[model samples]
Target: NTVPIYEGYAIPHAIQRIPLAGKDITEYLRGLLKERGYNFTTPAEIEIVRDIKERLCYVVHQNFDAVLKESVENTSIEKTYDLPDQRSIVVGNERFRCPEILFQPKHAGLEIEGVHKYAYDSIMKCDVDIRKDLFSNIILAGGTTLFEGIGERMWYEIHQLASSNNKIKVLAPPERKYSVWLGGSILAALSTF
Candidate 1:
């Protein structure tokens, strides 16, 4: 979830933006499918790629290289997803690799820091006294953070960079994807005369 980091005085610090989100992952998966000789140019086919990403893509916190190697070797990691057209495609590393782009944008050919670094860096730019609070109240709200293991991975990465005295907490609400709209609704309600 991307957001503008602000200090205790409401001073804007930094904005954490993810360059390789779901859409980019879908495009990357499409490229991989094309390389595997599965050509798809139609709009329906594009939707299939998005479906596959949403239904299958996940984050791998550890042993990423091993999983990729197993996928390349055509091992048990592979699973066939049947499409609406009755066609099936084998998905292995693509599942984790796509989401991995969030943690490692270099995988998607992007030269930017990962989400964890972005968060930590933004917090660091803020005043020292409030850093602890910022670290403790991390709110993850977005479709990308909904991916399985994403919150855990983000917590781990951020925790690794945080001081021992700092309490790190990463919260991803159940309705995280709609959090922005929900927040707007709350503001409107409270501000109404």
Candidate 2:
């Protein structure tokens, strides 16, 4: 990609206007430096310290890039590069489907391509062969799964992904938002834990 880097005297003014989480860049940096034990004895000292630190960090990262490149080559796994417009493309052996998994986990398979499928697989992998079993009871919790339509989508995906002979049952809490924290609280209360 041809990304542009700003380098003139006017770059500071440009950077000052950049917004992050509703705050400007200069305001964010000023607040960050204030929290990081940086007190302004003089304006010159502040600039000098910031410049030195920035240069040092840049130099360290520049040296590390060669090492990173060499390490990446040693791995046998092929990598995928998913474009913004193309989400469901698989470049190597690994599939690179993104938001589509909310609809079709079966498109990936039994091994579980990603997080949602992993959740489905974990429940399905339980011991169902026992005569008296607690295998039917399965729960889904966590902030990531608390998104709108996520619970039902996951349920449908699990059933769709399963083989014809197998069935999956995943029960999500009514308040999926606080389920993980509630589970943690229960675990902490247990004397056995």
Candidate 3:
């Protein structure tokens, strides 16, 4: 229990409580072992486990605090009247939009930046010509990509990330979010892939 929690388990509170409250089956089993002449486990092992678990919990909390501080300090959304209509707003940029941050730890959040890099990497694994064509026709087909300016943002970022010579474009179907579902229905109706 301590080992698992110390290794940055997501819900350490629930984990810690289960053993102390006698609500965890695994904890009960461990206690049963101790009662059954398994006195081989010394006090030193218990102390060691406790120390490691506390250290892990501290590390995760500290990192979370740092990321929160960085986000607060760097990203601020302003709704000032910067446009003719007096309704323009500016949303600050943060590490969250940087897809590379997903695979690599940024500030403190768990690495899983976004899908772009994953998709790009997957495409790169294909045959050279296929990969080239894939890159040429890269499309973000998902419901979450429906944010108002997401298409343009993705186009700019991905173009910057990819080779300067390779043309990068983000194609949005009419009703972009539902395009995949509509395409699936069309394909199924036509008995096509």
lDDT of 3 by residue, 97-191 (tens): 22223223232243343344544555555555544555566555544443344456555655656777767666766575576587668868975
Count of residue pairs whose backbone atoms collide, per candidate: 0, 0, 2
Candidate 2 Cα RMSD (Å): 22.6
Q: Name the 10 consecutive residues with the lowest summed lDDT in model 3.
A: 16-25
Error (Å) of candidate 1 at residue 185 is 1.2
Query: Given candidate 2, what's the lDDT at residue 119?
Result: 44
Candidate-wise lDDT, in order: 0.79, 0.37, 0.39
Give TM per candidate. 0.87, 0.36, 0.44
Q: List the residue pairs that clash in candidate 1.
A: none
lDDT of 3: 0.39
Number of colliding residue pairs in model 2: 0
Maximum-TM-score candidate? 1
TM-score of 2: 0.36
Predict model 1's lDDT versus the native. Answer: 0.79
Number of the top candidate by lDDT? Answer: 1
Residues 1-193 of candidate 2: C-alpha lDDT, one tens digit per residue: 0011122111121122111111121222333345544443466644533332222211111223353365446543233333233642222211112222323333323223434454444434433452012123335554334434445555565556565555445566777658757767987998987
List residue ranges in candidate 2 displaced over 4 A: 1-112, 128-136, 165-167
